[model samples]
Target: MIGVLIFPDFQILDASGPISVFEIAGRYAKSPASIRLIAAEPGPVRSSSGVEMLARKFGSPSAITTLVIAGGDGVEAAARNPCTLSFVRAVAKRGTRVASVCSGTFILAEAGLLDGRRATTHWVRTRQFLATYPAVKLEPDQIFVRDGSIWSSAGITAGIDLALAMVAEDHGEEIVQKTARQLVLYHRRSGGQSQFSSLLELKAPTGRFGPLLTWAREHLGTRLTVADLADRAGMSARHFTRAFVAETGTTPSKAIERLRIEVARSRVQSSSEAIERVAEATGFRDPERMRRAFIRAFGQPPQSLRRSARAG
Candidate 1:
């Protein structure tokens, strides 16, 4: 059985994302592994987003073969708690295969479970992690790191990638591909795949141009010219240019390209659609144009990113 122990104020995806992958793996594996959600307590646990989930609490480590401790804000305080730290130490003593997601590293390191082990956590939390757990060898660049049976992931979304790798380890390549397809996720994102997508969070501009930015996201497929956008917003080109830059950190042309890159990243992960087809659908005139835009934003051609998704 593969067991995950979640704590209070856990990141939602830190639990849900990995489960989505393993649930599919359970169906296709030669010998299905049981997946369980174990919490520190039996009652409802609140997530970072205020979503609540009821979980089975295990005060002691069970006979489960694989154990994962998920991360969140409650982790810092939990790591310091005698009960939580003792529970973690006991689990490690049983030779359980232990792993952590994002900030969950705190609890494991606190219990001395990660001493001299290669691990990772959310990139934004690296400084705190280093300060708290100096014995662990923390690698900031990886999406996930595995040293022997102990595994750790960088952040919430990366947990899914780590879970897929675990599935691959248990069932082999074909089963991992099937699971990825079922979950609509990447097969094996290289541990190096980035945590941030500046394009995905492309913040909408405010003030008079706010509505215009919304209109643009809705109309990315059209041949949108600055003149056309200005006309739609009922502003002169000169005034709109200054205001647009002030509102969004980018210009009109760059924003459209960034939006398109975000769309392309999703398509590459979820579909076997041809690159050229994706380029056209997302408003690129041709593959070359898309290549230029992709390189400027992602530092690699679109195909390279797609290749990383399939790299084991």
Candidate 2:
């Protein structure tokens, strides 16, 4: 049985997304998989979105093949609960495949289930999570990570991706493909894909600089410097540099490089454009420079990523 653990103020999609994947996969499998919603306290549990779900007591059936913990605003409190931590620890000790969605990793960490293990959480919580759990090998850039029996994912929808991977493991690629089709997901994103999209990361700045970042994306083929961006934003170079960093959590050069990489990667993966042309079009005039940037950003060169994309 696949069991999803929920607590008060848990994110609704964190549980439901994975549940849907499992449910759909079960339909196409020879033997259907059983699913259950569980909680420390058995009853109607309110989600962070204000939706309520009926959850069975955690120990009601006493056995589960896989146990997924949902994450949300209440994770800090849930992490502190002795009952919740103990329950997670006990289940993991029994060799059950244990996983956490987004902030739910805090609960597993508190229970000492993720100590010295490679794990990932929502990208937004990367810094705090690293500072809090110094023992965990946190890969904040990954969409999901699996270490031994413990699994973790980046954010809400990533839980669905993690679930699809689990289904693929238990069933097969064909089963997961069918499940993905039913769910209308474009494709099952690989775990190695980045958590941060170039456009999304740049649009993170909510201030006056937000529109400027969008403009930068549109003109990636040209050289973009702090001075150039400052002129566009109508600010002095020094002030623009400080403001850009303050608003975007990144320097102007880094932001430009990210934008270029995004466009370059998209072209590489989706088009038959030559690597040199892609580099020039994305403002990395030097093919070698683009290769290095790709290596830095994705742990692989452009050609390698292109090959992997094609193979997939």
Candidate 3:
């Protein structure tokens, strides 16, 4: 059985996403998985979104094979609750595969389950999490991380990714693929994938030059020089450069490079395309230049990422 542990004002999707994954996966598995909502107080638990879910009071975890704790604005209070902490500790001690979603990691850390173990939480919580739990080896950039029996993921949607990965582990890749398709997810993101995307890192991705960036992404094979982008945005090259830097926190050339690298990395990981061909299609033009860019962005070359994806 898979148990989702929740508290008052928990993030709705943090619980729902994983529930949906396991529920859908069960349909494709020979032995379907059972899901239960467990909480400190049985009855209706209101989520941050004002929605409520019925939960059973905490009891013997002997039947639970996995426990997924949720995270939200109320996580601080939840972490402080003695009963909540004790329940979490008890669950972990039982040898269940314990996991956390987003700020739910705080609960596990507070219970000392994360000491000296690698984990990750939402990027927004990196500084606070580090300051609060100095003993944890936090990898803030990861979408999800597994250190032995304890697993953790970045933010809301990342919980779904983590759940999908767990489904893959429990029921095989085929079941996970079908579950993902049923959920209409484009693809299951690998744990090692970055929590941040190039477009998201930009300060004002949907602002002023958003359309221009969209155009650039679609036509990455063409030269995306500052002058070219300036012409497309109908501004002087110097003015465009200054405005782009001011708005996005990066120069036009750098932004374009980041965009190219993002697209190239996705293609490299998701496709069997030749590295040289990927480089040429993504505007790197030269394979070595693309390789260097991949190293700078992901700390690994394109080939390594491809190999890791295949292995996964």
Candidate 4:
């Protein structure tokens, strides 16, 4: 049985999205799966969005094969509750697959399930999560992460991705593909995809440098330099570099590479363009240089990503 643990003011989608995927997968599976909404204090638990879910009191941990904790404004409280933490710890010790959605990771971390484990959470909480759980290896860029039997995901929608991945694991790629099609999702996104799109990352600041970023994105085919960007921003090279880093939390060169990767990746996945052509168009004039950049950014080459995208 899959037990989704919830508390007051939990994110509604975090629980329902996964539940829907599992429910659909159960229908097509050889053996149907059972699911339940569980909570420390059973009753009508209100979600952050004002939707309420009827939850039963968590009873026997042994009956649960999978335990997913949902996250929201009440996570801090859930993490502090002895009943919730102890339940999670006991279930994990019994070898149940433990998982979390969004800030639900905080609860698992508090229960010591995430200690020395590679995990991820919503990108918005990356800084706070890192500061709080320095022992956990956090991959902030991933849409989801699986380490052993533990799984974690980014935000509400990513929970659906996580559940789809679990379905793929339990059933098969074909089952997940069908499930994705049924849900109208274009494809099941690989966990390696960045949490932020290139445009979203560049949309950080609307300050003086914002226009410069826009110009750089448009001129990706050209050799953009610090001096060029500084000239556009009407600042000296040295001053612009420091100010750009301060505003965007990344160096100008790194930002440019990220922009190129984003555009290149989109073209590679969505178009039938050759790798060399895509690389040149994205400002990585050399195909080999683009391959190295793809490796650094995604832990795989452009060809691998394209293959996966097509296969999905």
Candidate 5:
């Protein structure tokens, strides 16, 4: 059985998305899955969007093979509840596959399940989560993370991805594909896929350097050295470097690399372009240099990502 745990004011999609995936997965898997909505205080739990879902009181979880926790405005309170924490710890101790959607990772962290484990939550909660749980190995860039039996996803829609991954593990890729198609999802994003876009990483997209960054993305084929960017921005190299870092929270070089990698990855996955051509087009110039950057960022080279994208 798969149990979806919810609390008052939870994000509706965080629960419903995974629920729908598992529901459709059962139809394709060899063994049909049994799912139940569980809560600390059973009844109609109000969601953040004012929708409600009926949930049963948490009881014996021995029959549950997987437990998915939902996250939303009520997460902090739920994390503080002794009953909720104890129930979570108990379920985990039984070796159940425990997962969290979005901010629901807080509940797992609060229950001490994420200590020293790589995890991720909604990108919006990165700083707060880091401050609260310094012991956690937070991978803020990942769409999802799996450490041992515990798993965590970024935000809202990512819950579906996590659930589909779990379904793929339990059943097979064929079933997961069917489930994704049934849900009308375009494709399942790999866990290594970045949660943040190159543009979104900037503090202010429409700020002083916005146009410069936009122009840089469009002209990735050219050398984007700090001196060049500074001249374009009408600032000295030293001043541009300082102000760019302050506004974007990253060095100009790193930002440029991110943009290049973003474009290179899109082209690598969506088209049949050669790695060398992609590297040159995205300003890496050397295929070897681009491969190193891809390994550092995505944990895989261009060929691997292309193969995975095509296979999926």
Candidate 6:
């Protein structure tokens, strides 16, 4: 059984988002899986919004195969709660795959389980996280960070992405895609945390443009023209343009441009190559075009981004 622990004043989605994905993945697991919601004094735990969710069970680390901790406004309180913090720390010794969603990283950090581990939390808390927990290697701008058995993610809905990754790790990509299909959510988020920090670009594009946008991402390094996208979708440019805008809430060109920019940004952040080299790798042949695209998309040029991304 994969047990998801809920706490008073925790983020609601952090508990539900990953739980839903785990249910679907469990269906595909060799031994399957069962989900249990454990709380300290299990009755109904109040959420950050004051909504009470009944936790089915009331126990700690020994009762489950995996322990998932959700984060929310209450995390600050939980961090200081000796009982709760002790429970979290005790779970680490149980040979369970421990994972944290969003600000839930704070709970683990407080338990002293995160010391010397490379982890990520919501970008908002990065400064405080560094200042408060100097022993941790905080990479705040990532979707998720895995160090041995510990998994930590960025804020809020990143819990879902992190869960999907966990599902992929446990099962495979086919099961991951299946779980995403069950939720009607396109598997994997585009651009990671960079997309969140920048103008929102790659999301689950809807309507008729969905397939086209997916295809565009699959072929980012190539010359992806509007006509090519239209051809793939079997629509004329005029009709495709209207449908693309309606589906994605952005024009086809804008979407592709954003996608390219995101791809470029990934290169800039992940590689030690020169800015010009990264630009060429992401489909911008010339350094100037890449710079302009970066400025238009992120208000900064590729060179500046390269330096900052590397420094971080």
Q: What is the TM-score of each candidate against the true structure?
A: 0.63, 0.71, 0.68, 0.73, 0.73, 0.64
Candidate with maximal lDDT: 5
lDDT of 3: 0.85
Across 143-220, the per-residue lDDT of candidate 3 in tens digits comes to 789999999998888899999989889878788898899999844553233325334553345878798888888899
lDDT of 6 at 258: 77
Q: Give per-residue lDDT, candidate 5, residue 286.
A: 98
Ranking by lDDT: 5, 3, 4, 2, 6, 1
Kindly list the per-residue Cα lDDT of model 6 for residues 151-174, writing each as its tens digit.
998888888898899888888899
Q: Using alpha carbons, what is the TM-score of model 2?
A: 0.71
Task: Show the lowest summed lDDT stretch of 10 residues, model 4.
Answer: 190-199
After superposition on all CA atoms, how large is the RMSD of candidate 2?
7.8
TM-score of 4: 0.73
Please identify which of the two predictions, 1 or 4, would achieve the higher TM-score against the true structure: 4
Q: What is the lDDT of residue 91 in candidate 5?
A: 89
Pairs in clash, predicted candidate 6: none
Measured over all alpha carbons after superposition, the RMSD of each candidate to the real structure, in angstroms, is 11.7, 7.8, 10.2, 7.0, 7.1, 16.0
Q: Point out the higher-scoring one by lDDT: 4 or 6.
A: 4
**lDDT tens digits, residue span 139-193, model 5:** 7767789999999998888999999999889888899999899888844653243
lDDT of 4 by residue, 89-201 (tens): 99999888999999999998999989899998876666578668878877766778899999998877888998999999899988888888888873456333342533246
| Model 3 TM-score relative to the real fold | 0.68
Which stretches of model 1 miss by more than 4 angstroms? Answer: 30-32, 191-312
Error of 1 at 136 (Å): 1.6
Candidate 1, residues 1-312, lDDT tens digits: the string is 777777788887888887778778888885656778877677888888899877887745766778778898888777877877777777777887788888887888888878999888776676577666767887665778898877898878888888888888888999999989887766765324232522225455455556776677777778888888879878898777645543442355656666677777778667789999988888886989888777765667888888888783
